[model samples]
Target: MPETTRILLVEDHPLIRAGCRRLLAQRRNFDLQEADRGLAALELNKRHRPDILLLDLDLPDGNGLDLMPQLVADNAPVRIIILSMYGDSGRVSRALAKGAKGYVTKNDDPAAILTAIDKVLEGEVYLGQTVAQALALTQLQPETPGLAELGEREKAILDGLGDGKSLAEIAADLGVTYKTVANAAGLLKSKLRIRTSAALVKFAVERKSA
Candidate 1:
């Protein structure tokens, strides 16, 4: 018989947490527990010692990274899979560096999450294809500013914009049409809530500093 894979699901969103539990419970071999915050997760970690950890990036009290070391100490055998909506390379890289065995975007199908859990359980690191590609690129170019929430195209355009280059020039350099660059810039403005190019540049600079 296969061993039961125990999972400790840590997420702040009630609906998401409940949905994930319901889905995971559908698997015959899973044993699951839930925690809504980082502190709660730590308490549960110390008590239940789950076989796997499904961690969210943002918690009410703190960033999930702060709990990773404690979790690793609590149960060295526990497999941690970071479940986040952001599929950016920087966050993926940081999570893996901090001991996450797997990183899968929430946009991934439920099966992807299940597969990641299974693979990590079998002692292999799992990174979705997009994340793996981004990580590979990050490795090849370490000096470039990596983003945790921005998409690849957005990161590239944003980087170009930071150099005070014209949108047309950036478009030409990227082989994308001018409207494509404009749309990308618009999307970034909306997501970042920056009204002016100056604000956008400022935000990018601050993120780089962080």
Candidate 2:
């Protein structure tokens, strides 16, 4: 960490940002900046070159996962800690694979955020309690056949299925054709090695519940 750690927090929710701002205020030698969207995050990151980035996975303009490569490339050696509501193994693993040094869920004890920042700054990876448990359970289970191979759209379709949405409804919500969603669902089944649509739906529900 530098003499004054420059931290950029990217989150759309004002209340959440304010809570984090208050929590982070307790730390000495910290300079904090905030951005609510991916575009603004990119701009601020370019200008400030923060030492640490507290990133939220969902942004109004784009998924934060999609923004990770650019941020990592632009800010070499800058540590990233993901602060998300999702504690699921899939999202956690994806975030880590994309270069996040730590994962902390919003529902975790606020201290977990500070702990993650400290640990990552010291060149250690940190997982909040809930995220650690989820990943441990995933490791213990029989791994899903091709879960890691699913692309963003496939994952989105699976999420839609988990929410009990029909294929047509998912297509409309995603602003894609119904056929597109149907094909993606078929691909999802193939990737997950599910024998039937009903089984796929069950898997999606189970994943969401996790």
Best by TM-score: 2
Q: Candidate 1 lDDT (Cα, whole model)?
A: 0.81
* Count of clashing pairs, candidate 2: 0
Q: Which tens-of-lDDT digit does each residue in 1-210 have in candidate 1?
A: 247877899999998987797789779898889998999999998898888899998899988877899999988878899988776765786788899999877777777788888898788999876577667765676442334577978987876776567789889989999999999888888777678877887766544323
lDDT of each: 0.81, 0.92
Task: Give candidate 2's root-mean-square deviation (CA, Å).
Answer: 3.4
TM-score of each: 0.67, 0.80
Which window of ten consecutive residues has the lowest lDDT sum in model 2?
136-145
Q: Which candidate should be chosen as best, given lDDT against the real structure?
A: 2
The parts of candidate 1 lying over 4 Å away from their true place are: 136-210
- After superposition, the stretches of candidate 2 with alpha carbons farther than 4 Å from their true spots are 145-193
